[model samples]
Target: MRQTRLRPPRLKAGDGVTVVSPSWRGGEVFPQRAARGAADLTARTGLRVSISSVKPGLCPESRAGRAEEFNRAVQDPATRAILWMIGGLTASELLPLIDYEAFGARPKVLCGYSDATVLHHALYARTGATTFYGPALLSQFAENGGTPELTMDSFAELTMRGWTGRFPTASEVIEEFVDWADDSRPRRAVPALPRKALRPGLAQGPLLAGCVPSALQLLGTPWLPDYRGHVLAFEFTDDNGYGPGQAARDLWQLRHAGLLDGVEGLVLGRPRGWSDAQREQLERIVLDVCHGTAFPIVTEFEFGHTDPVLTLPTGVPVELDNTTLTLLEPSVR
Candidate 1:
């Protein structure tokens, strides 16, 4: 069965973006930082920003309320894009409560990463609407030192217009961080090593991913998009240190579930904090799981939980030839 993917209308400067907290209510503790993200988004994208009335603490207090806010954003004709402020463990809980009918009716650009993967796959599976597995308001937009310049520039370049060709490569990476503990803390760049390509091959197909842990959480549930024929991507974000041992086990679980079956390819983002040995182990795990398959696999090609991140439209078709990955079309109308 060939599923038709939905493209959102292209967003431009002066469009409206609603910011909401789908998972953790970190915004309550980082209100000022959250506001900074809102302001930065406006200043940077020229899009008017409207944060949902549900403040962080009170908002997360009720999962249904968060879903309602997301519903409101989806229904509001003014909101051309919806950006999650940050991610947490429980976005999956909102899956049952989301206003899919309201959202599917007028789908537009909806973007986030990490825990937001729940929504990305669910939205794609249930509505066929493409969602972005990219930066979040507080995580990337409001990143200290003004979020990474490359990240902001790339986001603007990709989303505001149709993105094709090679995504701009990061000369530097954001591998470390200082907490957004205070509104007054100065934004600073995290340390990075230049991005590297770990494997080489060519493959093409629709995109499917979730941080390994999130993938495990959503897989076999109603949320995960069909894995058949997808260019599957996996990265892990410290749910339990996710060391090489843990990561390999997670991949094992995914493979065991048959979720990795018949994928067109597999791409991996940088595993944060992994040593050279751990990264080596991850490669072995990929080989172990995909031993007999022709699926091309590559690692550390950016596009998850990492800074200088690439904005990827979940469910969109992509081409990967070695480290050179390309989008097949503009993600929007």
Candidate 2:
């Protein structure tokens, strides 16, 4: 989207990671779980995690305290990477407090998803720094039975070694509804059901995008990076309970804003709650907008709002083969 600027190498065993609460300060209200999540990262990664002071009593409103905590985490020399403690609705408020110039001076991995997308875009746009659209501490690490090994492996490849490759087509797709709190759910072989292609041609570019609404929220903001020559990758959760039409409207807005006008490719992460009819409607909308465009449009990637979510590195080079709808890239570093 902008001039390519890579961050420092991903963390290795013994490297330090910091956990900060940029969104909701659940660590103060829900201290036990938050503490457990920080501890869990050490156990899972065999790396030390430093907890930021701002995590406790993080205010959702625009407060200097929360911003200072996030800035401290970013500016810390010992911190090789920073992970969000949780994602909620109000993370956008902290955008102003982030000194992108300072972040640019010392680029490091900033990782999270959903609400954290705001920070990801802001950092990427202002500094050309690569950010990650991956699982957070509380949702990914602290859950019972610990983090999924696949998820951990993806994190390592993307963050530590920069391993990027086409995600292996899941052998068995699970269409059943499973509870997030259930420890057994992630272990199951939930193969992703394939959807028909919108356009039949391959395209390649840097991968970009996160939760749909979060991306849309930055449409007119200066923080929204240029999408040209980037493959748009997105998915949505049911948290907002948006209907099919509403979802279509968001995509339509992207088209109207010229965000989708000249993208090299498009990867539609599986929309979590769309019915079969709604899915078909989405397919039509995508096809309509991209009718004369010569880029590929692949759907049903097994990332975002899906179990066994594959962590993706934003701003990494990617190749999409429309015939197979397969995504290929070197391991993210």
Residue 281, candidate 2: how far off, in angstroms? 2.9
**TM per candidate:** 0.92, 0.87
Writing each residue's lDDT as its tens digit, candidate 1 over 1-333 gives 224457788889889999888888777778888888889888878988877766445545588778877888988899999998888898888889887877678888998889898888888888888778888888778776576777777677667877777766676666665656753555434455544444557888877766878868886677777889888777888555568787778888988898778788888887766777887777787788777777777787677787777787777788988767788877777
**Clashes (candidate 1):** 3
lDDT of 2 by residue, 19-75 (tens): 887777666666665667678778777778877765456544455777878888788
Highest lDDT scorer: 1
TM-score for model 2? 0.87
Which residue segments of model 2 deviate by more than 4 Å?
1-3, 55-61, 171-191, 323-333
Best by TM-score: 1
- How well does candidate 1 match the true structure in TM-score terms? 0.92
